[model samples]
Target: MGSSASKAALAATTEEPMEPGPKHLADLTQYINETHMSVAHLADILSKKTGSSSWVVVFKALVTVHHLMVHGNERFIRHLAARHSLFTLHNFLDKSVGEGYAMSIFIRRYSRYLNERSLAYRQIACDITKVKRGASGVMRNMDTDRLLHTLPVIQTQLDALLSFAADPDELRNGIVRAAFRLLLKDSLRLFAAYNEGMLNLLGKYFDMRRSQCRESLELYAKFLARTAKLTRFLRVAEQVGIDRNSIPHLTQAPCSLLEALQQHLASLEEKKDFLCPCGLQHTVTLSIPYRPTGNACARRTWFADYFPYTIFTLPSPQACWSRAAKYGASIETDASGGTNWQLSTCASTSAIWTSVSGPPSPHTVTSTMAFPPLMSPQSLVSSPPGLMADELELTAWAGQQSQSM
Candidate 1:
């Protein structure tokens, strides 16, 4: 050979690309599409292969499904029946059990996808749960495509995924961070939608075969706890493959994952007795009387529901005082009769004694020894402080005139 021919021959032998056959080329796509029909087609192909007697066929099918599922044209989903494809995909996952170890790998891959998709409904799970019950027959019928035996097989698939799931490597696979977030969202949904079926599903993965369910829970707990160290809520849904807003509620069963989560979160939020509105700490003192009466007497206990930036004026401070006096006002009490937050401090002995010293103003004092000024509720509602001051001054002046008479 000539020198040029020799160099060309060496280059061809060393760097030649293996020409992919037509079948292999058919299975591979350069760009992943997110179309529903394409995804369904890919899944159907996978299901058929998963049921195949040949391991190579099953493996190739799984590769094809994974490729299409992740990289398929997302826009195609608009034209596809999302619900139908999910059901079909889930069905394939169910039958994967009989397909052996390779099948298990495919199921695990599908589980990752499921985990991702489930996360998409994080914000709307409750809304979906509301519509979950009383769904149309068509919706219910869709899930019934497979027999119970085939359907329940997904629990095992989930179990296998848990077994093989690793701590998503952040170095090479920083995608695990997103996975963690998606898993966290899934955990929330599982807690919210915790029905017998889902609980059983979680139980299967946690108790029956592998410990990864428990491990993931622990890892998530640690992650969330660490999140508490930071003030802002973070978004990690896409990492885990969840939509965070795609929760679809097809029915409303009593024991759904949404219900469980709602109950759990309700209990948690209720346990918080205090709220710092401005994220600042300040003290508020309230005094309760020994025998509160009238409107004030009707008042039981006061607790701050929300913080007020400034003090609000009451229509009748005396009415409040009369209520407080009934209880023989105590400084130690943290609460008073009104729901409105009011700042209080103990009155000096002189302030109390001075009011009582000349109080032979019999007409102004009621039989209960509290102010009995004849101010109507309407007048109290209208003028408030001015009306109250006028009433008190008139009462004192009337008493002095009566003394002179």
Candidate 2:
């Protein structure tokens, strides 16, 4: 492509979605696809345009990049993915002073998503290449793992795509309008990949890590809620002039469809190994089993005499005795509370125990229990019902104990 022709097409790209009209876009794409233009030259122009102070220019440049990626040459994609710094757009800013161009945040985010998309596509292409090269069946498992890795990348890109997710006001911005035309276009495809891959993961890979599987489902549920919320935004999308054709998937994919998929995933996840919050999912769990024979001020939580499930969250029996001697517990000591994350559940009982002494560990059995805060119903939501009454009764039983174990 002649420098003059390339310059005209770049100049033609303005706020109007069709400004760099199809012909100009076609000719420019042809140059990059056919190698008449160097990928480096296109990269430099895209970098500068995306990094512009004007949000309009940035949005248009992003559209151009999207255009070429969708309709341009394969080499261009590889070059962009490998040379990610060329389009990082991490600090891209919009200095246009107006309420209309409320797209700086959206543009910055969309640009990053595009970068991830490019990288993701490159990985996909590599997998295809491996297949064509007659890669052995051994590569299959490795590829599955790679796709699992890509799941979150796609999820995050989709999240960023919806920066103005349900906000009709922000979605109305001209830059936002143009950006979504392309952004949603890519998102629809990415959404398919994510949903499909998730199904495969749950269906074919039954042995996948429980924590990863559950976390993926939770993230998927988050997307389902967003889509349900997007219904209103989509109605506004048409009122604001976004093409119905471009967002067919966005408008057609039902929330129920996603919900069913989520439930399926959850059911499949349950069939896998159970993940105990006993902290054993990751590293070692410290069991602080405390028996308060002499003290009456400590809280009583997760005091299972049998150590039922061997859940690491349950303090070991012998450890409880040692813990009684070290930290100590009392039924009447006013219980100070801790955040839920700091609390550990007992495998033997459903009660969640908080460590009044230190991090809930082996040193935190019955002897180190922290009682209910304020002794009010609202303050004890995490604990079982009538826990206050039980603690009071237990306190009465302990008040008469000798000052020795």
RMSD of each: 24.5, 19.7
For 1-405, candidate 2 gives per-residue lDDT tens digits of: 568545845775665534346676777777886765567777667677765666677777877777777666777777887873656566766565664244666666777767766766566553221121111221222444665566666666566655545355665544455556555445444444443444344333324454654665554444444443333344455555654433322211112222222333455444423221122111122334432232111211222221221111334434544544453422222234221213222111112233223333323333112211111112232332112221111111222221110
Which sections of candidate 1 miss by over 4 Å?
1-43, 53-56, 76-99, 102-405
CA lDDT of every candidate? 0.27, 0.45
Please give the distance, in angstroms, between residue 377's alpha carbon in candidate 1 and its true position after superposition.
Answer: 67
Q: Please report, as a residue range, the 10-residue window in candidate 2 with the lowest summed lDDT.
A: 127-136
TM-score of each: 0.24, 0.51
Could you say which candidate leads in TM-score? 2
Over 1-405, each residue of candidate 1 has an lDDT whose tens digit, in order, gives 123322322222221122112233233332223222333443343354446443334334443433333333443222232444332233333333353443434445544455334333232222111122111311122222221222223233223223334332321232223233333332332222222222223223212212333332322222222212111111222233434233111111111122222222233333313221112111222233232222311321211101110012233445544543444432121234222211122100001111111111212222111110111212222222111122212222222332221
With candidate 1 superimposed using the best TM-score fit, by how many Å does residue 267's alpha carbon deviate from the native? 14
